[model samples]
Target: MLFNKEYYSKAFEYLLESTTYLIIGGILAVVFGLLILEYHTIWSDNWTVLITVIGWIALFKGILLLVFPKSFNRFKYLFKSKGFINFLTVFIILFGCLFIYFGFFSY
Candidate 1:
């Protein structure tokens, strides 16, 4: 199994990159959701800003994670111990999607 190091490392790298992006994306989504909920602003005023922030966060986070995979191990341990951040993330994403859907498509 020594030969699997390459694959394992690649997998770990991708996981670290993607998870960090998702976390940052999730935070941006929530922040936008709150602004949309509280301010009643048009999507034109908020969507681009939120998306740009989230996009940049993802891009930078991916680069950082790839360059320093060791740092993410601490978060993995914290997440494993909590066991609820995943669920919270899922709920937040679902709520954000629902809000967006209703904001644009529904009266």
Candidate 2:
């Protein structure tokens, strides 16, 4: 669903609009990647491993985006459904908020 090329025309344009954005994104990628990579290494941890893989992917994407700023331009048309995209965006935000809440208060 998210892989649809129609949705990427200007996806990271805002975040990768300038050298400052690239630098910031790169820093975040390194931190997020290390933290995620450090947290899960065992294959037995399926879900965690999945997330770790995502982290690594994020790191790689971030690095690539920073190094070759024009590369991400290719992702501009992966998806085009603004309605579904907006829905998914909201879902993700809510899901993240729930996680934050659970992380702090689940115990």
Candidate 3:
């Protein structure tokens, strides 16, 4: 979806228009984040540390979504920016690769 400009824009716009979707997504993010943290709170190893950080980020993003749904309108411009989308896509791919390496090869 990130690569597809039209679809991405449409989806983002749909999300912006639907406060109920955002609220549900926010709740889910918070629940999943808490679940992750519950088991990996120690952060003893690299994997644990990474998971913990992701959990915290999810929790923070969920809180932001729930508390400031209107504020997200300010970021709509970012979804339209091809450069930002490319950067975000690259970042996601790299992050996924890192997770894969840590999950399968680090040991």
TM-score of each: 0.44, 0.56, 0.88
For candidate 2, what is the TM-score?
Answer: 0.56
- Arranged by lDDT with the best first, the candidates are 3, 2, 1
lDDT measured at residue 54 in model 2 versus the true structure, 0 to 100: 70
lDDT of 2 by residue, 1-107 (tens): 35652435255445444667767777788778877778755565333455666778877876776688666545434334466566766778887887686668756
Instruction: Write one digit per residue (lDDT tens) for candidate 1, span 1-107.
Output: 13343454455446555756656645655555555545543346544455455445555565555466457755544344323444555677886897698679765
Candidate 3, clashing residue pairs? Answer: none
TM-score of 3: 0.88
The lowest-lDDT stretch of 10 consecutive residues in candidate 1 is 76-85
Please give the lDDT score at residue 45 for candidate 1. 57
Q: What Cα-based lDDT does every candidate model obtain?
A: 0.54, 0.63, 0.82
Please give the range of 10 consecutive residues that has the lowest summed lDDT in model 2: 5-14
After TM-score superposition, the amount by which residue 11's alpha carbon in candidate 2 deviates from its true location, in angstroms, is 9.1
Could you say which candidate leads in TM-score? 3
Error of 2 at 83 (Å): 4.0
